[model samples]
Target: MIEKLAINGGKPVRDTYLAYGKQYIDDDDIKAVVDVLKGDYLTTGPKVKEFEDTVANYVGAKYAVAVSNGTAALHTACLAAGIGEGDEVIVPPITFAASSNCILYCGGKPVFVDINPDTYNIDVEKIEGAITVRTKAIIPVDFAGQSVDMDLICKIADKYNLTIIEDAAHALGSEYKGEKIGSIADMTEFSFHPVKPITTGEGGVIVTNNEELYKKMLLFRSHGITRDSKLLTHNEGPWYYEQLHLGYNYRITDIQCSLGLSQINKIDEFVKNRREIVNRYNEAFKDIEEIITPREDEFSNSGWHIYVIKLNLDKLTCTRKEIFEALQVENIGVNVHYLPVYLHPYYEKLGYKRGLCPEAEKLYERMLTLPLFPKMTDKDVEDVIRAVKKVVDYYSMENCPL
Candidate 1:
């Protein structure tokens, strides 16, 4: 089952399946999960604390709250940051839907901003113009692991008394302006989806320096029920509890925490391997005028969660669709990072037209995400490169320089 393609009628192609992203789980990770399975607490327990502490310490955040997934983390983050009804949260339309959806979950409206072409991130300069009396927060996504222009973003936030919630789902190990990203924002959310830099089988976390926000998120993550008697007006029993606020059961299991701990132990190695793959990709496509590779910010560091390349259609004989199909036929897995949030039929009805964000729209039309993960081998890299070159060559026959 593993050797055959799940699509295209299941024909055998290679010895193994090459996914766009995958986890590099070693024996230690397996053992950790197994140990949790054998332990008393399979849900929230000591391992969660250890995992949270590890993340907090690593990212220099004062506290971290593990949640069910990134969306839950975002929801809790918005709630913790005091985003409420009548509040307007400025968010980039280029991000995943959850980034904007979180604002709505907090009973706030989402004000969409356009993105910068080269970075594929929210345009910080364009952000200030969208602010209004109700504007309360700014959620800047670290698109594809590259840190956003935080210095300018923070500057704007300071200028407007706006709260900052970094959608760092793609940037766990990324840094900005010499400081780690999680520590920079008022609240930061991270994801551990299978395709992300790490895996916890759908886990997420909220990291912050504010104690009030941390406590609020903690309560929000666990059904808003509290066992501490101090918060209760009167203690009928020693087991008295309090419901301070409306919340959800967005708690993570100890099994996931156990896996996260193991994964964290090898994060450095995973990042190193990914960097090696990125270097290879950069070199392989360096001279190819048909694509534009991702660029790095001089003042920031990245985790490179995805390796997206923008197509240069002017020099190509094939359309984006044709090249994509050709690559699929050649057994290369391909994906588009996103369709602009505003282009979705739901948003279109909300008056978000095609030309609103020219830069993001143009980039969206041509971008393709190739296979990238720590598990990719030299042969896998070579195969992807060869497949891409073949597709480009086959489609651009007469237009080919040779």
Candidate 2:
């Protein structure tokens, strides 16, 4: 017999709600933070530098600058890239607003690009069509921890002489053609939010191979105030500094970096575990006609930040919202990954209208994020699978066209 859905007052798949993403904080992480708290310097300290160096080395980048959060990282990267008024930056519409908002922060216009229907990343082939004489850069996001086609993106950037600011918030440990995400782009930014692969309470970092850009980011994060004698116009004896540019106080605290240092030590294991869970999810849903699993490209090894599934709505008797709610009733904390950045009222007020990216808007209507985290046990994975299957089974239609 087909099981009754919990939304219809039947038994739930699980007793407790499972969040879509969560941080895995162990005793070691707590100890690392405590060690920093007990030390002399809590804000501008050795721990922050240590964390930055570790990340840079791990990603094979020449330099890394730690900042208050991911948004600041993007903003500082934009500032370092010399993005100014009237400059245009190409960005995909499927990502978080911050991806494009950074361009706006630098007084630049963001030209929205559509995503490839399969990868849900910016369509590389269509990128050149959006470029104009005003175009200055391209911000390619590695959506859902899958690397964008860096080789193709690099070729495009080189041809246009445009800088590539990779938003790698979802893809720290992900690799493109055997190279780490952070090392491929001109400047790559990573987030250390609670729900990210690692947690620093709230923090971010930008990695780059260019020393000029690295130095600029360093100055930008600390209010453009520099005590370095090489940078100062005129230095007085011992105590002297200069505020060369209008910059924000985006410095990250050592306390957060301490946690980040600890968490990063386990990143490989975390990524491995996430991939294992994704494998389980893929296998469980492969036979379900009403579900379309995420696709990882041949050259990309994803870190699997969040497992997203697109419903084959025609094969089911319900809408995505109905399935989402049904999964919630079954104690599965299903959620939408995002609405297109331009669809938000704020962007709409900025003169971005609908039909800008039909593919992104269509995908938005059918996509759902399932529970995915490094700490999720096998049972947690099983519960999510059972809940989704139960909901889809209850709503599935007969003789549905593929």
| Per-residue C-alpha lDDT of model 2 across residues 39-154, encoded as one tens digit per residue | 99899999999999999999999999999999999999999999999999999998889999999999999999999989999999999999999999999999999999889999
Top candidate when judged by lDDT against the true structure: 2
**What TM-scores do the predictions have?**
0.94, 0.98
Per-residue lDDT value at 245 in model 1: 85
RMSD of each: 4.0, 1.7
lDDT against the true structure, each candidate: 0.85, 0.93
Query: Which candidate number maximizes TM-score?
Result: 2
Window of ten residues with lowest summed lDDT in model 2? 393-402
Q: Kindly report which residue stretches of model 1 are placed more than 4 angstroms away from their true locations once superposed.
A: 1-17, 397-402
Clash count of each predicted structure = 0, 0
Model 2: residues with Cα > 4 Å off, grouped in runs:
399-402
TM-score of 2: 0.98
| lDDT value for model 1 | 0.85
**Which lDDT tens digits does candidate 1 get at residues 32-139?**
999999999999789999999999998999999999999999999998888988899998877788998888787888888888888898988899899998999999
